[model samples]
Target: MAILSETPELPKAAVSPQALVGAASPLWAYFGGAAATGLAWWWMTRFTPQNLEAMFETAAVAPLKAVEVAEDAVVEEIAAPLQAAAELVPAVTSGTIEAAETVEPVMGGEAAPLGPVAAELIREEEAVQAAATPVRPRRTPPVPPSSDT
Candidate 1:
């Protein structure tokens, strides 16, 4: 058998533009529909009511929690000083009593003997009276006597 050197050329089929468009239209529609569906799904997940509510709740709660913590710290700071003052109350009371016992009252040019209890009661009463009473305004200074009277 003799081998032919030339290769046979295949017939080129003529394709119409309408047929090409018709064939690709379904694929374009499918891809476009898939893209639209994917976009809708992303939008729904990103802006869901639950997601929005949680984001707002976190924003609201963070400041409230910080305020609560600051309030607790302020209360603790105030209480520490008050607690220290309370502990000193007994010592101060005993010292006042000791001073009262040693001090003698001068009444009508005579040394009057007064008890510590009586002194403490008088001091408390005076304090209460002073607190209850309102302060008086200052009096105007007296004018000089006129030269021609």
Candidate 2:
């Protein structure tokens, strides 16, 4: 087999004037996009703040507060059920059930009453631990190989 020529002939695609105009313009397209984005941002800030704030205040605060409230409500609701279940266990084991059973509430209703000194000591220990331990830096130190242990 023999090679046809040093230079290879390339096939040409048929392009129109509209295509040529479209082709001349990657820069223009990028600039137009940037300009349009700026304009949109300006427009949104100017025209949309009142409506946005009304939505935003409720939108931001409500969900977070709602989530917290929901979590608290769930905990509150589950506690009574759990306490009742715990009380029932004793009844199941022994056939004789007391009419006036004193079931301890499960909600941990009382705030943890840690002494000020104890709380301070715990905080100090945590601070010491935080200070003592430094995270290892990204770059590893080069290790020299040993000939013998």
* Winner by lDDT: 1
In terms of TM-score, how similar is model 1 to the real structure?
A: 0.25
lDDT of 2: 0.79
In angstroms, the error of model 2 at 24 is 3.3
Candidate 1 lDDT score at position 23 = 49
Summed backbone clashes in each candidate are 0, 0
C-alpha lDDT of residue 25 in model 2: 50
lDDT (tens digit, per residue) of candidate 1 on 1-149: 23455667768777655666764555788888999999999998897355788889999999999999999999999998999899888755887989999999856877678899999999999999999999999999999999998
Please report, as a residue range, the 10-residue window in candidate 2 with the lowest summed lDDT: 91-100
State the displacement of the C-alpha of residue 42, model 2, in Å, after optimal TM-score superposition. Answer: 7.1
Q: List the residue pairs that clash in candidate 1.
A: none
Model 2, runs deviating above 4 Å: 1-22, 25-58, 88-149
